[model samples]
Target: MAEKGLVLLYTGNGKGKTTAALGLALRTAGHGQKIFMIQFMKGNPKYGEIQASKFIPNFTVVQKGRDTFVRKGNPEPVDLELAKEGLNLAKDILQKGEHDLVILDEINVAVDFGLLKEEDVEDLIKFKKPNTTLVLTGRYASEKLISIADMVSEVEEIKHHYKKGIPAQAGIEF
Candidate 1:
């Protein structure tokens, strides 16, 4: 890890964005670093990461969104409200200098879906503490997000089992 922490953005259509973020969280936790993961647009309790998180000490995970997928350009009031709540929480988490790493999972998708304003995300990046590594994970990462990131990785998907009619499995795809 960088001495001053690093801003990392994981985006693209491929799977493992969140998986990579969680892998970071796990690695950080193994080293006794605190990690706070705020999952935007993910209210599903069945995700393997969420369940695995229960066993990791100092690894806090919060899911803020509806279980059902929010339609693009036609989100429900609840979806908007939940995303706002998560953003507010993110602000507080960043300002307070609480955790070593803060992961905003699926936040880019939230912005793309109009559940969150891009300006607010820019603010999150701007206001983050110097020593806090902020990790944003999700598809459709905005240009602004790419610009602010100290490290950016785009997960490109050439092939996926889901394309072959393999449903999302619990441990792998949840």
Candidate 2:
């Protein structure tokens, strides 16, 4: 474990927020470091990352939402419950300091969508171990998170293939 773990925040109205976190996870795995990714508002196991986890040693991906889309303004009761469950899992993982890298995928979006409270997440982050690198990925990151992070990257979507009638590719977008 490193002496000083970093708090990395990847956010913005863009495409690479989660991709950036996944890249770190890949690098961590390459170095034989353990990584645990808790995917919020994403339950589908068909995502490339989740499928790829089977072959990647020491990398785990867990999703905590239904397969269907979660309505932004009016999320279901299960959605709220799942988000809380994911948060609790994250807190336990952070406290244990088992993984070298811990990623809360789409956490910012979950907060922005009111699935999780910002204060709850802020409190959760306080439990991070000194040796565990923490990552938060999603759009609409709050100012408090950005201020507290050791590194923050906002992915700006200058252009997207979806706008040009191009569907998301399997490996590329998944």
**lDDT by residue (tens digit), candidate 1, 1-174:** 657978999999989999999899999999898999999988988888888888999999999987898999999999999999999999999999889999999999999999999999999987789899999999999998899899999999999998899998888977
lDDT of 2 at 39: 98
For candidate 2, give the lDDT: 0.94
Clash list (residue pairs), candidate 1: none
Q: For residues 1-174, what per-residue lDDT tens digits would candidate 2 score against the true structure?
A: 437888999998889888899999999999999999999999989999999999999999999988888899799999999999999999999999999999999999999999999998899789998889999999999999999999999999899989999998989888
Report clash pairs, candidate 2: none
Error of 1 at 147 (Å): 0.6
Error in Å for residue 50 of model 1: 1.6
